[model samples]
Every structure is written in C-alpha cells, then in structure tokens.
Target: MDVFHVTDKDGNKITNEKVIDYIQQSLGTNACLLPSLRRTVGVKAASKHTAIELTGTDRPGLLSEVFAVLTDLKCNVVGAEVWTHNMRVASVVYVTDDSTGAPVDNPERLSMIKVQLCNVLKGDNDKRVAKTVVSTGVTHTERRLHQMMFADRDYERVHNGLLESRDDKFRPLVTLQNCVEKGYSVINIKSKDRSKLLFDTVCTLTDMQYVVFHGTVDSDGPDAFQEYYIRHMDGCPVNSEAERQRIIHCLEAAIERRVSEGLRLELCSGDRTGFLSDVTRIFRENGLSVTRAEVSTRADKAVGVFYVTDAAGNPVHAKTIEAVRGEIGQTILQVKESYSKSPSEETGGRFSFGNILKSTSERFLYNLGLTKSLP
Candidate 1:
C-alpha cells in the first residue's frame, strides 16, 4: 500500500497522505498515480528538465521515440512503468526539467507539449487528448464570487497574464449557487462542434455532458462563440478498491458522528468509491442504520444525495451535517474533488485540471476498447 498526498495546481495541500494503491490500481495502471506526486512538487519549484514518470498505451518503439523527444527537449528520464492491457501498452516515465524551469503554463506551450508527447507515443493520428487548466482564486466574500461569475475570459487572461487567451465573452452562465440548487449547470460545450475547440477540449477532459448553448463566428478577425459545459453524470464507475476504501472511511465517519447525536446525514454528492460502505460502517459503528438513501456519480464527480434516517426514516440534525463536512472533504472527497469542487453538490461543475486529464485518459481507453478488460 502506497501513501500519497494530493495538492492543487498552485501547490496548496488538499488531502493528507493515505494508502491509495486501490485508487491507483483502479486507474488500470499503477503508474496512473505518478502525476499526483509530480503535481505536488510545485510548478514554481524551479528545476532543470527533471526526470518524469510516463504511463499510457504502448505502441511500437513508443519508449524509444518518447525518450528521443525528451532528449531533444533536454528532459531527464528517471523512472518508468510499462505494461500491456487490452492490447495497448502503458508506460510511466519520470523526466527531469521541463525546459522553462517548469512545465510552462501557457496554453500554446502546454498544447504543444501535449501534441509532441502524443505524436511520439501515439503517432500522427486524431487521438483525442483533453487538457483542463484550473487556477484557484480564494474568495472569502460573496462579492468576489460575483466578480468571478461576471469576469470575461479575456479579462481573466489579462489579469492572469495568459499569452494564449480564451475569448473574453465566454463565461459560465450558471453560478456555483445555481449549480448546487439546480443539480446541473446551464452552460456547456458541444463535443460535436468544431468551432468550440477549447470548450470541447474541456468537456472531453472533464467528461462533461454538455448541451450546446450557442455559437457564432465573426465575418472579420477572430471568431466569437460561447457555450456552457454541464456535467450530467460521472462517466466512470467506482470499480477500484482504493476509491472504495476512501468512500467507506468518509461515509462511515459521517454516519458514526451523526448517530451519536441521534440523527441522519442528508447526503447530496454524486456516486463515489466507498460511499455506501463507509456510510453503513459509520452507522453500524455507532449502533445506527441508514433507513433510505440515494447516491451516485455525475460526470466523473462523486455525489451522494441521501436522506439518511434511523432504521425507520427520520431527519438527521443540521448539527450532525456540520460536524462531518470537514471529515468528508478530507477523505472520500479527495479523489472526487481533486482540485475541483468539494465532493458535494454545493460545488458542482468545477474541478481541478488533473481530474480532467484523468477523465480524458479513461475516456480515451474506453473509446479505444482498452479498458474493457478492467472489470
């Protein structure tokens, strides 16, 4: 059992280190967890191109080709994991130094790196790879929320100094408050449209099910388009033992803490790893039982909106919920949230960039018939 700590893009600690081999194995490749460690290293931590771990479907001479490219980029190869699953080869390589002190956050640079890596690993083909970039901004007040809601993407770029900026007009129509209350967002990207390049990339990476809201192209200069991306359901299932453990720990703790007070928990998160098991354990530990519940995943995010009761259905106290929120976020929510929103309906349609990448990898394998052997 390997323990790992999860962090945000800006090097903020999100979850404590815990044994998560089950989660890594659930990823269909133990190497899938490599990026988690790299991310924690902090992008701002300056280093020459250092060795990095790489893992994915393997092709002929894929390793050699990738190494060749790494050599050209002056990156070091420190570690690797290569295996074949469902007729695809997956490899993990640890490279040092990302040329620009760290992997450049510039959109074009990131895209170029992805393309270069993919070309070497996958060759010249329309293999779909989605990349999501999420930058967290702390808003201790509601006024800040309003600003984020209304801020244009270009304004965001200018503020953030993004060289390859997205359209200024594009904005998430629904606010976080709206998402929680509505159980869905009104904005989203259309996977079928070619014009919504960035939005489509985000949707694919995040595994969002978006209904095309609107689109337009300018007769002169750059085109203008806006579409909202909404998450309908978490595309993958909690088939991994690791996710199951975390879920169980969180739910059980929540239930146990609540039962001591003679109440139930009203869960409003999506499907997750050990949700039911954890909830049940907590109830059992505290001499309680869940009367009725509803839990599930929405678009790669975990949620469990359950009206917990005693053996007989009864309302849980508000205090019980308040008591358990911290624990829930600390454990089960780590994989679900992953720099995105908390693993609750309160923060939906928002997620970390790495989660989006993981989703894209899963989608790619599933679409290509590689994950069929997972179950």
Candidate 2:
C-alpha cells in the first residue's frame, strides 16, 4: 500500500519523464502539486440558511408550537431534523427569510426567535432548563444533534411515574472491555440494523474524546455487530468502572436518538407558510406525539416524514388514526408504515410510497426519483 507509481487515467504506467515535463509545461507555472492531498470527497456546500439548535423536555404539540412561532416571525423553514429520546427532544432547524430566501441575520429578529422558542421549549412543568441558540457555523446536522443531546445529558434515565420500559429486543447491547496488552479499550455493540447506526456510535466516541485506532462492523439481516478499539486522547484506556458505564450509556443514547419509534406518516402537499405547523397541530389534536421527523422542501412541494405515537408514548389506537386521516385528508397524508409495539394496534399495511401516490403527477414522481421521465 506504501508503494508509489505514476500512472495515467487508464492505469498505464508513465515511464517517460519527458511526457510529465510536457504535461507540466502545458499547464501554467502557478500550478504546483502538494506531497499529499487532504480528502474531502463527501463534503457538502455551505447552506445559505440560518441554523437554530434547540433542546428541551419532550412533549406533545411542542413541535407544532415551535413551527407556529417561526411562521409568525416570517422565517421559512427549509429543512429540519428532529429526534426524541428518553422524554427529551433535540432538533436542528434551517430557516431563511420568507421573501428573500436569505439567512435571517438581523440581531433583533434572531433574539426574538430565540426568546419565543425558548419559551415554547420551557413548558410550564419542565424542571430542566430549556436552551435555544442560533448557530452561524457549519456542522454536520446529525453529529451536531448528538453533541447537543449529549450536552443536555439525555442519556440519563427518566422515571416520571410512568410505566415506561424499552423492549429488550430494541435495547442495544453495549459492553466495554480493556485490552491491557494492546493498551486500548474495546467497545462492542450489538443492535438491530438501521441507517446511521455506525455513524451514531462513532460520533459519540469522537465527541467523548476517544480515538478509534481500529474497528470492525458486520451485519446479518437485521442485526448489526460493531467492535472498536479506542483510547483516550491522553493515550489511556478506559480507566474506571464509572467511565466504562458512562461510555456504554452514551453510546446507547446516541443509537436510540434516531430510532423511529411509532407509526410512520408521510405528508406530501403544496408548500405553504405554516404548513408544518398546521399538520403537526392536527397530530397533537389527535393525541399523537412526534418521536422523529424529517422535513424538506423540493420545488413547490413540501415533503415530511414523521414518526408519532400516543401522547403517553403508547401505540395509538386504530380509531384515532382513522380520525386523523379523515381530518387531515387521507390523500395528502398517508401512513407509510407502522412500528407499534403491539401488533393488534397496527393500523397500516406495509406498502411502497410510490404505489400510494400513484395519482400524483409524473413530474412530481420524476423529481423524487420514483419514476423515470420519458423522452
């Protein structure tokens, strides 16, 4: 792997220095090659919108209220990612001016936005302080969510006098073992396979100031297994039992934050101001609480995917779902899947979203890559 050889695009070795010299001469003299090039293969362009970070106690209708406040402030939400875990919610929302489509940079307006959002986050009975901040820096959305939740200490278990229990199968198996000979702490995780599973655990370790020297990941059907050899930044392995447990809990929280824990709902409709606010209001009215949400706009259409359960985090009844569908228009908002813990409470069948939206225009389907446009 350390061997070096100069080759053309076709993989043919270039043995002639004259050819290299000619190529260099053809280019300008200002062009110079560095000894090594840092890789940035998957970096995305900077967003032209303002990013707001929010974390607080989770509750029904909280997201709706937040969106309503943003709409009232004339801030248009272009995108957002929301996650809820252990009765704590954290979200990163990207917004722009409704008219200019530019980041809302006015200091006064931003302060008002923060104040209103902070009020909504700090509901009447929240014991922990809610937080709201406007961020000007660029950060990976998902990674930032992990950092925020970690800082908010979402890993701590909450006992709010409710019979809340996570299913054994859904709980991630996290164990830490120290390798004395190798001078590394090994972390092994076994959990159900899903998108970003590795990313969540690695981000947690990285944020905790651990360096992963080596790692291996394997998945079999729905289950995934990961092992990482890591050490502290100070070149030490996990030094104490408390630290080991802390790492384990943090990793579990990271993985669980993104878990969609309820019935999946997909909303496709024409973009409009307060669209999310109205829809989430309907959900709240129907006694549903959003566990996870991904909102985006493409062209003139708004696309949102939400996972929601009963306000108390129990499976929603079939009648409640029917009532919501009837009120929200079944065609515009469809149930894509169900993740209810109780099979008897499941109301929707597993079907492809494209099949459900067959009546939509071909252009819309083409834009979503659900169909190919004919020449």
Highest-scoring model, lDDT: 2
Off by over 4 Å in 2: 1-47, 159-164, 339-375
For 79-152, candidate 2 gives per-residue lDDT tens digits of 78888888888887878889898878888887888888888888898877654444343466677788878888
TM-score of each: 0.23, 0.77
What is candidate 2's local distance difference test score? 0.72
In order, candidate lDDTs are 0.31, 0.72
Candidate 1 vs. true structure, TM-score: 0.23
User: Compared with the true structure, what per-residue lDDT tens digits does model 1 show for residues 88-115?
Assistant: 2333333444343343344454444455
Candidate 1 lDDT trough over 10 residues, lowest sum = 33-42
Q: Candidate 1: list runs displaced more than 4 Å.
A: 1-56, 98-112, 124-375
Residue 353 CA displacement from its true place in model 1, Å: 32
